[model samples]
Target: MANIIAVVWDFDKTLVDGYMQDPIFEEYNVESKEFWKEVNSLPDKYMKEQGVLVNPDTVYLNQFIRYAKNGTFKGLTNKKLFEFGKKLKFYKGIPDIFEKTKKLIEEDSKYKEYDIKVEHYIVSTGMTQVIKGSSVMPYVEHVWGCELIEGEDKDGAPCISEIGYTIDNTSKTRALFEINKGVHSGDSREGVNANTKIPEEFRRVHFINMVYVADGPSDIPAFSVLNKNGGATFAIYPKGDLRALSQVEQMRVEGRINMYAEADYSEGTMAYMWICNKITEFADRIRKEERDKIAKYAGSQGPKHLVD
Candidate 1:
């Protein structure tokens, strides 16, 4: 069996400088801080005013959809969101990390016998359209986020109809399981929530072959799931951001992460080296298991009696 390594990531602060919405908001001449301020405030406002408890993640997606529907931004459409994603800036070595890591494993003679497959996935509360349109999208295998529903208008222009999905803090763990089960969004609608049993040997990806990287406390649930399952969890903080660093440090102290590093992912940086070494370690461990299994099977067979 090929050794598959799943590298799951959190989009926002983990991959980019700020929220992915920053560029989108800027393009529309909207103030990102003020917009997010309202998005953050709506849940409490709704619960107190209407007694309707709303998911905070849903509130943000709804607000964006509302903005798009009202024509607040010129030519606002799913296509536009993807275009904005193309313009979205990334942190130092982001999209490169995907290809570089894959090449490192493939080219190394040590891991040649073991078919090491590196898969990238994004589990975020960010906008799915933007992420799908972003430059890094090509590097990712799948994306789970708040998705926008698009429909055609009388003018044949695409319009935002509603939110198709919402991936919040707590819901992030579901994506991890989906990866473990090798189920994707479009594959089976009921697969994620279905209780169908799958045997251990048939499982696509093992927990020990997974890695999760996120920015802060919002990812705690995912971190816990990965850490508990023998997978690796990495907490990253923005460079020189003392507050972000302090928060990340707290998560480490609480045992929510296996390691913490600066956001710098450039070649030769500590974070990059750390991930490369971890991949190597995981690959080596799997290779050893294969060898041991063969050895045990060979030993189990008794010496053949000589046939006279």
Candidate 2:
């Protein structure tokens, strides 16, 4: 039987467009462009005062999630996040990309020989409800991302709180650790159940075996963890965005990711083909190694018919 290949992805910028900008803002009646303009101005108005360089978008979004958690804004409740989720748009070719990927995996003889089951998962700091509401929800096994604690307002109306949503590395890390416990221990070769806790002593499989797709600094820790440990991280950017592409290259140089690609799904596109080929190649290599190990052990046993 062939080994399983698990493809873990980050939501938003990676799998789909980063909606932190448009629809999300529009849904809440916030001026999208102005919000980003103010976000960009923060470094000069705030961070620079403290002798720090800040990416306003990151700071702004982080703060917004915090404020939303505190109920300072009306209609920005956790449920609203899901309602807003329905309006998100994709860059281009996302739906086709997934369909093509599935076809490629199912048709590849090598994948079939190895019993390779391409299990796709979403690991994000974005809200799970938003992911569930997205079009891709049907294809993925589950989404592991920031979650809200559902409760009620003083008037007994439904309310949402980011009290437990992961917005920072520490929280994100914990969420990742808990969601995919076997990653930390490495011993989950057999498989993992969603609700089961990970056992100690097994480190998660290397990212080389995983094609991690993500965007932004919040994804850095997860990206870095995969890259440093031999897994591959692909930093996705909007098509023709030179600046974001530059950032992806910087991350590559910094050893946070392995490659950069436009979020396109055309045949032979780097993202699709590379991942497809690499998965087959990985399976072949593992097979050869295991065979070699078995051969070595057999040799040590000498002639089976010979009496000891």
Candidate 3:
């Protein structure tokens, strides 16, 4: 069997310094802090006043749609989203980490016969259009996130019609399963929640070969899913950010993650070394299992008969 390893990441604070919406806000002349403040508060306010529950995960997308309808962002099209992506900045070594980790596994002598493959994925609550347009998009195999529905052009400007897909904190686990099942973001949604079952051995990426990396509490569900399934979970924080460091420490103490490190992805950093070592460990185990299986099969073939 070909050995496959998956590295799944949470986008917002894990890869970038701040929210991905910063550029979108900038383009629309909206204040980043105020936009997020309203996005976080509107749902709660609506629930209290209207006695109706509005999903917090989707409210921001809806707000964008509302803004488009109100002519606030006349040219907020998919193209614009991608353009905004180009302006979004990422952390230390980001996209480089993907290639470096892959090289580390492939070049190792112990994994010579093993067809070791490393695949990267992003599961975020951010906008899919923006993420697809980002610099790290090329490095990731798939990106699962909230999506916007586009409508007819208004004065030659693309308009957002509605919220198509909304990914929240807890729902992020679904993306991990999708990755495990080899379902790409562009693939049909049927596979993600299908009744037809796939045997464990046939699954594309085994739990033991998974690595889930995220920044904080919002990713607890993903961390729990990976850790409970024998996969690795890593909690990362910005360097010198005491609050983030304290939160990561709390997560580790609570047993929500297997390890915690600074968000630095540069070569020789703790995050890089830890991931490289894990790949090596996973590869070694796979090689040993193959050998053991061969030995066991050979032993089952009771004494070979010698014919003269």
What is candidate 1's lDDT per residue for 1-308, written digit by digit as tens? 63788889999999988888888787888988889888899988988899999987668877876676666654677778877888877889988998988888777777777776778899999888889988887778899998778864445556776778789999899888788877873233454442457665666778789889999998999998888889999988999999999999889898998888999899999789888888878888888888888889988968898999
> Of the candidates numbered 1 and 2, which has the greater TM-score value?
1
TM-scores of all predicted structures: 0.92, 0.72, 0.91
Q: Which of candidates 1 and 2 reaches a greater lDDT?
A: 1
Candidate with top TM-score is 1
Misplaced by over 4 Å in model 3 are 152-156, 185-195, 299-308
The list of candidate 2 runs beyond 4 A from truth reads 33-80, 152-156, 170-206, 216-218, 290-308
Q: Please, what are the lDDT tens digits per residue for candidate 2 over residues 78-122?
A: 667766667778756665665555656667775565454555677
Q: Judge candidate 2 against the unseen true structure and give its global Cα lDDT, from 0 to 1.
A: 0.62
Q: How accurate is candidate 1 locally (lDDT)?
A: 0.82
C-alpha RMSD of candidate 1: 2.7
Candidate 2 residue-pair clash tally: 10
Pairs with backbone N, CA or C atoms under 3 Å apart (clashes), candidate 1: none
Model 2, position 101: C-alpha lDDT score: 58
